[model samples]
Target chain A: MESDLVTADMVEATEFPHLSMRYQVRAVPRTIVNETGAIEGGLPEHMFVDQVVAAASQS
Target chain B: MALLQGRDRQRVQSELASLANPVKLINFTQELACEYCRDTEQIARELGELSDKLQVEVYNFQIDKEQVARYRIDKIPALVVEGEKDYGVRFYGIPMGYEFMSLLGAIKDAGARATGLAAKTKAALATLVKPVHLQVYVTPT
Candidate 1:
């Protein structure tokens, strides 16, 4: 959220039915990081940041 | 019908009062084929009414090719929360229910030209040289 290198898009699963199917979204608040890793459900702020950072750090 | 009720309206108004700069909600929608386009545009319009610092712009997703390309919008009912410069924050679909808070929060962040991410998180993000795309999938409920 603080970096210009990051772009965060909140996608409404129902409205974007095709995207939902593509991402295999089975529940609300699923976060797809770098289009590779999936974070299911809501996480605490620190944990969420950690996961996102880790995902971004991955090659 | 109004999506934001009395208490919700009050809350939004109060939250928007802290805005330090002008923010624009760039809404992309189509006249036909999109089920939630109208509602999404309405949300942008209503939020615009809540603050003088907020501006709402509506563009046809199909007709406005330039804007669509500029914002890299690929979906209908897309809303871009932009301030003086784009921070790459976007909302696709109607941000209702719980996601409403995210919209409000993004507006605030855009207006402030800063995110409330912790110092450590900011530091972590600064280390990234490659682009990171985050798509958070949610339902209105």
Candidate 2:
């Protein structure tokens, strides 16, 4: 079974209060969608950095 | 305007105090305007106590323009992990909640100058020598 990690309440509780106002809180499956409307999962740290570096280099 | 309420401030302070390593927070709002600027400031301040466990550095984009361009960061409140070499790990939004773990992991990897992937995972990752780009955007929920 897929473990239920990081619940909605947990996310709300950890957010810095003032910043929370800018985001829309929805209870749907909790998907992370990018500006391009693509859903993504939690990426590993190294891979994420590599991506950013690649993007920066392309600019 | 204060981004953190008194209660949250106390909680952050206490958490920082308990950490073994200090972490540095670089704030980008000063250059790139964003709504969460104030909140990022508060986070940087609260993370001060963790200095012993991790070295935390706060940089405002207004002052650190060179670094920002180098990292190709076009957003406010991005975090970069500084290690043996700039690993280029960045968090575009305030790294709280599940993201916090990612942030901490980045810091740990940076500090150790190593990625703690399993042998099999590392072997697989080695094949990706060409390069890969990934961007993930999410709301606080």
Candidate 3:
């Protein structure tokens, strides 16, 4: 996803409290989609892609 | 203590030798405020030292408002790994432990000017009609 229209940034939870709280993050490896959809934990590449693709379509 | 030890440093140097183009690592941190800021700075400095194609640019997070906003960096120890262009690869903490491997991989990928994504994934990405902002959060543990 990084090579194309997607831009991925890794955020450190403790270091970025503002961002963490913005997403209401309380667990590790949590991914928020479009700053809304909260995926609680790590997902497989296929699933991750699915979520992103879905979000893109919705947006 | 030095982060990259004797043989470890040598291994990293060899890996960095494969860099196809110049890679710029931009780090943002505020002194006397951010945890692991020193460690992150040290890592980027050492990594840049591994090869001439790599460069490290440090900026104050709180003071460098323009740079911070330009990169959209919202945290301390923020690192942006960019090649000829911004592929939007970002690291928000010290690349220590397992993440060090990820950092190396990112540098190689960025420097190579290509993503190692699967062919199918590339095709799928090619069909993307909207820009996606992906954030992956993780703990150092």
Candidate 4:
């Protein structure tokens, strides 16, 4: 989700605990969008798109 | 020893061949007891060497106090990928497996000053009024 509208960061959870705490990541492969939006677990491509759109529009 | 195997190296080289501008990878690492620091530096350097327009700058995370503060780096094995401008792109820890593709993509996007998102997505993104920060968590393996 970077390089265009929003800047995204790939945060290694173990290395950056501060970020994980800030983002409140509880599971692996969690995508925190706009700080407030989040999607956890593996998602299908279409569902992933919907989730991203839903999450982004929420903020 | 080569960090990237033969087939991977070939793939990386080919992918980086079309670089339009220079990309600087600012890597923060320490000499002692840092897991994956050496491996991260090695990969960044190898990628840099593959492309003439790419460069890597390795800095001691503890010793380079000024650099650490400058880049807002909070931990070791951090990489700040810079292209036309600092896009606030950061990669924490070693980008391996699928994550490595993201690294390569970021470099290409930065170097070309382009984001290959779909037109609809780009248009929607243009309408964003507030700043959004994305934190994608993944296990490299």
Candidate 5:
């Protein structure tokens, strides 16, 4: 919502059962960055941004 | 059929009343073979009804290749929330339950074209050199 380099998508796990399984979504609010790094649960805005930046930098 | 009713409608209307600018909800769906497309479109329409500042546009994913590619929609029942500019905020499935709050929040943010992020966070994001894609998985409940 802020950066041009970032895009955010919210997926309803129940509606898309296949996506839930594919991403191994066993919890609510599991944020997957770049389809690789997974951040489970909600974090404070500051922490969440840090986690997302770190996740995006993952190899 | 009305998706929002009674207190919910009043509450949503109240929230939308404070919108600083106009927002557009671009809904991508197909006529057939899509289970939730109808409900998704209806939800967008209902939300559109809540605020004149918000507009809803429907496109057939199976037929509207140009729009599909323009929005980079890769799935059905998708809703793209855009303000004056495309902020790249998208919902891959129906935004019900907890996600509904997120949808409303997105509308407000997009309406203002501002994320309301703190300066620290904004500065952190400014350091990003590569594209980042975030997919948050949640349930309606």
Candidate 6:
């Protein structure tokens, strides 16, 4: 159910709109976070922590 | 399955053998057999030599339901970092590619009981007084 909302195509379509269509198309199903911003894709732990901290600081 | 073919396996074996700590691999699938076992054991042995504190523990899930439940693992081929309180860090697939570095970092962290955060990162993290739950999913390419 969650996967449907954040399919690779959806991620590519939504996140990096300025990138080339081919690169965007290839980057689908990337990291999709819930409303609370918990990512549901593979990420290095440190990078994950960095993202989380960055998001937390923003809000 | 042997994720590495021939020369790759040898290279990985050599790298693993050079570690100063022991790294453990817990095989949770009954479907895995033979060379997989031998290869994993070889890796574990190498990881052991990596560090004085390194240790590898393999759990064949076919016989260890309690351990699986204790680890809160519901999938096959999962990795658990064992150290002060277990950390709850898990990998649902074989740690390879970029994931291997994360696995090694976790192992070293556990061995040293170290959770290293850069000063700036630590300072930022300290601002979060509330509980935060994070989950990341990844497919090995």
Cα lDDT computed for each candidate against the true fold: 0.90, 0.48, 0.82, 0.81, 0.90, 0.49
Worst 10 residues of 4 chain B by lDDT: B121-130
- What are the per-residue Cα lDDT tens digits for candidate 5 across B1-141? 698999999999999998889999999988888888998999999999999999999999988999999999999899999998888889988888888899999999998778789999998899889999899998888
DockQ, candidate 5, comes to 0.88
- Residue by residue across B1-141, what tens digits does model 6's lDDT show? 444557865655555544453444444444555223444444454555444555656676677888878776655455666664555566545555566666666666655555575566555556664444333443334
For candidate 5, give the lDDT of residue B136: 93
List the candidates' TM-scores in order. Answer: 0.95, 0.57, 0.89, 0.82, 0.96, 0.55
- What tens digits encode model 2's per-residue C-alpha lDDT throughout A1-59? 00011111112212333423323323221222221222234456465434433443443
lDDT of 4 by residue, B1-141 (tens): 888878989998999998898999899998799888999999888888799999899999989999999887877798988987778888988888777998999898888888766666555566666666667888766
- Give the candidate number with the greatest DockQ: 5
lDDT of 5: 0.90
Local accuracy of candidate 1 as per-residue lDDT tens digits, A1-59: 47889999999999888889989999988999887888889998788878888888883
Ranking by DockQ: 5, 1, 3, 4, 6, 2
Q: Give the best candidate by TM-score.
A: 5
The clash count of every prediction, one per candidate, is 0, 12, 0, 0, 0, 14
User: In model 1, where do residues sit more than 4 Å from their true spots?
Assistant: none
For B1-141, candidate 2 gives per-residue lDDT tens digits of 555458866754554454443334454556345656666556655554444655556666777778778766666666665554455456666766556655655666555556565565544444443334334434444
Give candidate 6 misplaced runs (Cα > 4 Å): A1-50, A53-59, B1-27, B32-46, B49-52, B129-131
Which segments of model 2 are wrong by more than 4 Å?
A1-59, B1-25
For candidate 4, list the clashing residue pairs, or say none.
none
Q: Rank the candidates by lDDT, best first.
A: 5, 1, 3, 4, 6, 2
Report how far residue B117 has shifted in candidate 5, in Å: 1.6
Query: What local lDDT score does residue A10 receive in model 5, on the 0 to 100 scale?
Result: 88
Better of 5 and 6 by DockQ: 5
DockQ scores of all models, one per candidate:
0.82, 0.08, 0.64, 0.52, 0.88, 0.08
lDDT of 4: 0.81
